[model samples]
Target chain A: MNTNFTHHQSAHCENGVASNLLKFNGIDISEPMVFGIGSGLFFFYLPLLKVNQAPAISYRPMPGFIFNKAAKRLGITVKRIKFSSPEKAQIALENNLKNNIPTGLQVGVYNLTYFPDEYRFHFNAHNLVVYGKTDNTFLISDPVMENVTTLTEAELEKVRFAKGTLSPKGQMYYPTHLPSEINWESAIKKGIKNTCSDMLAPVPIVGVAAMRYLAKSIRKWPKSKGVKVANHYLAQMIRMQEEIGTGGGGFRFIYAAFLQEAAIILKNDKLKELSFEMTQIGDLWRDFALNASRVCKNRSNVEDVYNTLADQLLHLANLEEKFFKELKKAI
Target chain B: MKKEEIPQDESNLSKSNVKELCYATDENGNYTTGLSTGWEAKTIALESSINTINERIEEAKENIKSGKASPIVYFMELHRMDWPTLADYVGLWQWRVKRHVKPSVFKKLNNKILQKYADAFQISVDELINYKGA
Candidate 1:
């Protein structure tokens, strides 16, 4: 009769039995375990979980040639002059050029004068002007000259006639701010600030790569979804540029560090290639920045040089586009 | 059943219950319970502890089976193993991106996997040598 165990006895035993503590980890109980499963759970399991980590990158330095004297000598100027008419100014230049006396001679504003690189190429009245502060000695205010150069009225006329250039643009020389008046310190700081503004944005070069990818995908298939994807990606590219244009220098340093560290983490051939290209681009950007600082000493011209540099960077980005397409396929 | 219900005992031989109980007598001549070791309860405790360990090890082994590479290498090219030498390895890694993974964590994982295959071949060679000796 006792062989028929009552439910009441089993319930009492079950209640006395302590609950088996259940802890969940990814390991399946169905398979053969190694290193003792229960021991791992009680000891090393939690510590074995992977921790999130991102690689590090660094900021490069500005080169030495940026502050050189040759770089600082670029400037522009706008002075008031007493010419009868545009036609007269043109004739005066022609006659002076023939006689070897460039009549447009004027004294320098700050003991030294500078000329713009763009104007140096041509002898046109469009950008070139002669100034006369003293009697016979006319200061050849050829906006083209880097250092102060003078010519007599005859010399100016002879050169002008030989050059066969037309009249200057306006009637009387207006008092406009000259390019030389650009505040150098403010300009340089501003230029640096604007170029580096986009540093906070992550993997900007990769964003550029993504945009190119979307573009190619569209061309290949031309679906609405592809177009949407591309448009979304292109927006990031534009955002990257805008940030860089505003004030991203600090971010550039961070990106450099990030890339440098990433160069270590990436083990695949494709990732290795991408990271190397990225680092190389960073180096090229530094070189371009140094060249810009050297070529543009003052503020306004610095901005101009930076704009040109940005354009060159964009041209280089086109090459990245082609490379990324190959990457997408390979990946 | 009735005979089993009544505790079986032999008067001629000694029967051991094996209960170890430590008790102290107070000044009032009363026994105070101090310690008790019941064999059946102790055995249950030990068995449960061992069972918990078995469960833990099972979980760990499953995780290890499913675990990806520590650095996580996503290889699209299966022909990577076909490379003959280390000289070719650098070129193969740099072929697509024009850059090398300097630390070579990915390459290390590939080599480790390759060694496992080599072990099986080595076992075959050992067996052949033994057969010739025999």
Candidate 2:
């Protein structure tokens, strides 16, 4: 905010990007002042974004609880590591490999403590990977990320590799560039990079949940064959959700809920046909998410998802209106 | 220097003879009051400097209106002026802004600017595709 202090510089201003950290007393300072100034600027420019981009500083318990409940209802295991150092992060990757977890995991190292004066956070997913070591100093590609970037010979030499840990999980990996691979050493020196890590279930459990719910909702009205059609459509959605991950996770829930609600209201024949087509849409949503979870984390993914959902909603806008009307009449 | 507008104090600061204006001395050997340090002369110089800065700002604004000026170029031009150079002490604008505005505000502004460019691109793309059919 106060560029007047005395410097010319472009900084990575967000997502744990560290600018020059100045220390006055023995205590470390800089981040607090920067955030304060940035927040002040945000107030001045609120009209510019039209929508406010400020995120709440404190963590909300409700959303996490809701997600946890959803996960449990769908029978998927959810795990979180609040703050893992480089060494500990490496260990998590190693454990995933050793256990044959069959799930893809990528670790990101955010702010790099270069020199005390010129530290910057690098959020490039490519650079923040965990590479396996062959012997004393050889590099190997992580199995989950094998399809992505293959390490070149020169890259291996420039990036320092040290062993790191993830306590409890206790997985191991080459913690590139840290002086000591031990947890305390890595934690103290490098400073922790605030990165959010999420893991997808080995298989699409959400898909299973959707299908099970669909089957249960329709079996009551076996003579109402339209329910069967809806189940088929929902089954496809579940499959896609399982394959894709977080990208499709939100929409999968919304659509699955819509279908479940629809079965209750619609007549037998109409419900059956609606279910069949919806199941396909569900599958598509899941595929889009699973195939593109990491990719969707980018800004373009936001635009793509919004546009796709908007277009689909437009297509069904009339039908949706009719569904409401008929349900009201029946009641 | 305008014939009708010249003040009577002009003779002290801008006399016809350079000797009185540049080297006038008092009885005590200190320079006389009316020559170099007169309030009238100070006010004139301040006015002229302000006019020059205002003219420059006007030109920059025109350039920006025409879509020919870069924000960085205008910002740097504003930077070059001294505090007293402008009529209203416009350097204070930057100081006030620097003190009040937050870094996130600047970032959001930059993003909004970028989004405008993105919207412009989207419009052009739509036009291009639609026109091709015609």
Candidate 3:
């Protein structure tokens, strides 16, 4: 029942799934390209929502947004389904495999046995593709993995219906139609514009402002919550910035790659320069993560470590603000 | 990051033989894909969180043994779930879920409710009721 699907490793899940699925449908698009057109780069700080006992921080949009937006921009038709019953979900997946369709699924990472134990958590927005089934096992093409893997039917079912935040509930999607011609230049411009607006949004909990708000919170955490609780929150923030999926640094690098690609397609030299600037910003994010981890581990003797970290974040917000503004003008 | 500068620090990911894909710059400053074994900062963050979870799991076991908490509390900690999250999974009210953390309430729970908790934890009812330790 194999669809002859080729597994391609990606830094991020949704972009990887989208790219791989598109390639299987004969589009031959790259992962960065898909991410760029999808306007995948984003930032949000949700003080009201708590995940793992810490405030929710997201470097990308909600699950399915990337692929859906990319598909729409590329004029590709996609079908997405969610089933309440696990039996019905299994039937639908099997039918897709029988027809040689590699279906994308949203599942929980916690129950995915193939993932390393250290990476498993209650987050339930992980994406993978099921290309075939043999006996009771399904062939999996998880974009974050280096090679193809297999999951027993029961194991797949558990992950598909894993409880907690953003439960998958046996959701699956795949592209059904691809346009013969794609207006690459226009799509790239639209993608860049959308990203610019999102990042430069005026809202406090969103975009660059969110980064600033998070910085202010970081400075207050240690003084208000005590050292131990503050350290725990800092650790959680660093995990969201560095450990989850591709994290903040990895995503910026991907976006930089997208800008570089778009530069050639749009014949814009400014985008080429902006790509390098984005990479530098990505490096700064990595530096921030490194320093924040040091503070968390108590390896830093600096008395104002929290304040230092806050300053670093503020710098990032300023740089991103300027970068997105320039990107808007360039596009 | 430059391709040559991509971190290959030893961490849980590297120890498990899992390499992360990253975008880096080549000699010409052109974007390219590279594989990072791990990074020290991320390793520290991950290890700390895991350690915290392990500590909570240990505390839950002690609480169960001392009759201060129910077997459900132990299972909940093992599954990395909090009261509200467990309630969401089992489709129960948060206060009810918290109340069920009491050993007395857990002992009096009906089979249907126990089954719901078991399903949420991905364990059989027998295992959920009789969980000793991992």
Q: Which ten residues in a row have the lowest lDDT in candidate 3 chain A?
A: A241-250
DockQ-based class of model 1: incorrect
Each model's lDDT comes to 0.27, 0.27, 0.89
Per-residue lDDT value at A133 in model 1: 27
Count of clashing residue pairs in every prediction: 57, 32, 0
lDDT of 1 at A64: 14
Which segments of model 2 are wrong by more than 4 Å? A1-70, A102-272, A276-318, A321-331, B1-134
Rank all candidate structures by their TM-score, best first, as comma-separated numbers: 3, 2, 1
Q: Residues A1-331, candidate 2, lDDT per residue (tens digit)?
A: 0111111121111211111211111112232122211221110111122111111111011112322332232233445442235455545544543543211222222122221111111112212222333333323322111122333333332222211111122212221121222232222111101000000112211222222222243233223433332222222232222311111222322222233333443333443344344334434533433333222222231334433433443333233334333422332
Docking class of 2: incorrect
Q: lDDT by residue for model 2 over B1-134, one digit each (tens)?
A: 11122123442223322111111123432211121212232223223333444566667656544645433223323433222221112223444334212333333444444333223222332332222111
- Candidate 3: lDDT of B89? 89
Q: DockQ of each candidate's interface versus the true one?
A: 0.00, 0.01, 0.69
The C-alpha stretches of model 1 lying farther than 4 A from their native spots are A1-84, A87-137, A141-147, A154-315, A318-331, B1-134
Q: Of 1 and 2, which scores higher on TM-score? A: 2
Q: lDDT per residue, candidate 1, A1-331, as tens digits?
A: 0111101000000010100000011111110011011010000011122111101111211211111111222232223343535357655544544543223222212112132211121122222334332344445433222223455554443333221112223222222222434343333223223222322223432334332332343233214334323222222222222111111121222222222333333333553454345434534544443333333222232234434545555554475445444533432
In the order shown, what is each candidate's alpha-carbon RMSD?
A: 41.3, 32.4, 1.7
